[model samples]
Target: MNDHWENMARQGSRFFGKMTASLSHEIKNALAIINEKAGLLEDFTLMAEQGRGMDPKRLKSLAGDIMKQIQRADGLVKRLNRFAHSADEWVRTVELEEALALILSIAHRPASMREAVLEAEPASTPLQVTTKPFLLENMIWACIEFFLSENQKRIRLIPEKTSDGVRIRFVGDLPLPESSGLLFPGEAEKVLLRALGAELRMKPATGEMVLHLPKGP
Candidate 1:
């Protein structure tokens, strides 16, 4: 393969790795919850077997918990499908809301695991943006994965507007100490964003990581 193709493949692999790691972490948490629920059910069953009195309400609650877990597992599977096939390379004028929804949906599991919220607010209208959908999604994914991993349960994303563009800000409660030097995407992600006339700025102060996308182009 040519060098260009090789580089593309490598970038794809890296992006996939970031996503898969987050997904695996999500699946693990889901399984753990399922296990705990099952154990609770087993305990209840043993109690009934020993002729212990059981509240009808308690049994109903246990069933409800199991159903909730089933739904959680299903949601994760659907998200995995959306993310695994995100990059199609066909340029499209994607709706910001829909695009952000997909990004947040896939990112939900990992973000929630850390006790943080991934909040996205698009412009009031369709807010169409021209770019490779997959690449943009991957860029946001990279930011979320990095923050969540480095400072587990410490990140939150908020959308804001700049004079010339839109900004996705990531705020953390316990920001990484100033003395600790962290290498955020910096030049590479910036180069890609710049080509699309977008920009990203990571500020450890106030625990903010911002992505600036030009409103016009």
Candidate 2:
């Protein structure tokens, strides 16, 4: 049990590190856009000072672009902050849709970079579960990373309530490998899911992966 927990801790650390790195890159890209826009605004002002009449529409457009990037950065930071706090508790009640949304947000940068679309199939009702939020999220990320690593173009998450608990279907076109090592490299994802009292199943024929989570810890 001690070794099991130690492994989880290590895995959690790696997940946090990878997520933070991706989030930082996203922020950097947003800042770069803002910087470029600001530079263009400065050039416009210089032209105005040189008696080159400024186009009001162009100035307004430039300002709008900068504001848009600022808003984008703000949203990313809020999501990153929420993710950072998920580690504060060992286990908590988490709304399934909300949790999955955060995972998708954090994974957006990498997914977009790979030109893969990550979407959640709309749920008619809320699915809530009590579990280790951070660990559960890491497990989801592991599954997503596996498919994204394989160059899969589209991944969809479908959440629904089960009689006993909740089920989240990870649907994509990439098939899961036969070997456990290939499906879950390093066995870290397996351990994390097991620790969360969740069951994972993959259908190679249909390229569907399912995660069954209990109602409570």
Candidate 3:
């Protein structure tokens, strides 16, 4: 592979690692809760065996808590699985709305870390696009990262179907940088845009940045 593609691959791998690490942490948290619950259950069992008596209601509540953790881990796994498979194909037809939601799911934690709320408004109808799914996610995440770095308090994403293409707009509560030209769509992002055959439009005055992705070629 050439240097450019190789760099992109390495970048994807890094992103994958970061996400998996975050997921593992979350899953671990759930597991730890379950373990604590198990210990309580064990305590209850011991009490019953010693004739000290155990509350059946407490046992039922503990079981429900364990079930909740299991369901949470299951959801995390499903999302991570979908994300991993997004890299399965170099290019494919992807439903834009589903893709947008997936990226937001994975990015919610990061956005929260920056004290920013990440919200999305889905298109009235599903928007489909032929593109590099992995790279496409990376680009959206790059936009999320950019907005998260801003002084803005909230970042709202909306995917719209346009006559010529699809416009994914990121709207913020505060004004985008007056010098967004200098800070955003950096060289790396430009490379990604070229790779995806996409365009980035920044409306700093309106606190909006739009990514225009063309339909299948």
Candidate 4:
């Protein structure tokens, strides 16, 4: 039992680190764009100081670009903050849709880098469950990373309320192999999911992976 807890701790730490690193890269990219736009604005200002006519439209466009990047950076930071706080407890009441949305927001970064689209279909109704939020996020992310690695063009997530709890279905172009390594990645992830009272089922014909999470933590 002690070893199990220790392993879970390590897994949680690794997941947190991975998420933070990805988020940092996203923020860095946004800042780079903002910096370039600001530099261009400075050049425009210099031109104006030299009595050279400035294109009002160009200046307006540059300002708009900077603002857009700023908003993007702000949103990324907010998501990162929420993710960090999610680990504050071992288990908590989580809104299935909101949790899935948060994980998708972070996982979408890697998908975008690979030129693949990752989308989450809005849940038809609110689905809430009690579980380990951080571990659940890690499991979802691993599934997404696997699909993205398979060169899937688009991956979709659909969350629905189940009789016992909630079910999140991951749909993509390719079917996941039945091998434990391909689906769960590692023993820690598999153990963590079981600890959360979650079950994963792969539907080869439908090209979907469905995760069934119980209502109680």
In terms of TM-score, the best-performing candidate is 3
**What are the candidates' C-alpha RMSDs?**
4.8, 1.8, 1.4, 2.1
Candidates in descending lDDT order? 2, 3, 4, 1
Candidate 4 local lDDT, 141-178, one digit each (tens): 87787678767778999998888988888898776555
lDDT by residue (tens digit), candidate 2, 1-217: 8888889989999999999999888899999999999899989989989999988999999989999999999988998999999989998999999999999989987899899999998888978999999999999999888878767789999999999999899888676566634555456876887888898887766677788999987
TM values, all candidates = 0.64, 0.92, 0.95, 0.89
lDDT of 1 by residue, 1-217 (tens): 3654555456657777867777777777777888998998899899999999889898898788878877887787777787766665546566666767877876776678677677765555445566767777767777777777666465556665566756677666767556323476644454456455667665666667777777655
Q: How many residue pairs clash in each candidate at the backbone level? A: 0, 0, 0, 0
Clashing pairs in 3: none
Model 1 residue 186 lDDT score: 47
The models' CA-based lDDT, in order, is: 0.69, 0.88, 0.87, 0.84
| Model 4, residue pairs in steric clash | none
Alpha-carbon runs more than 4 Å astray in model 4: 178-185
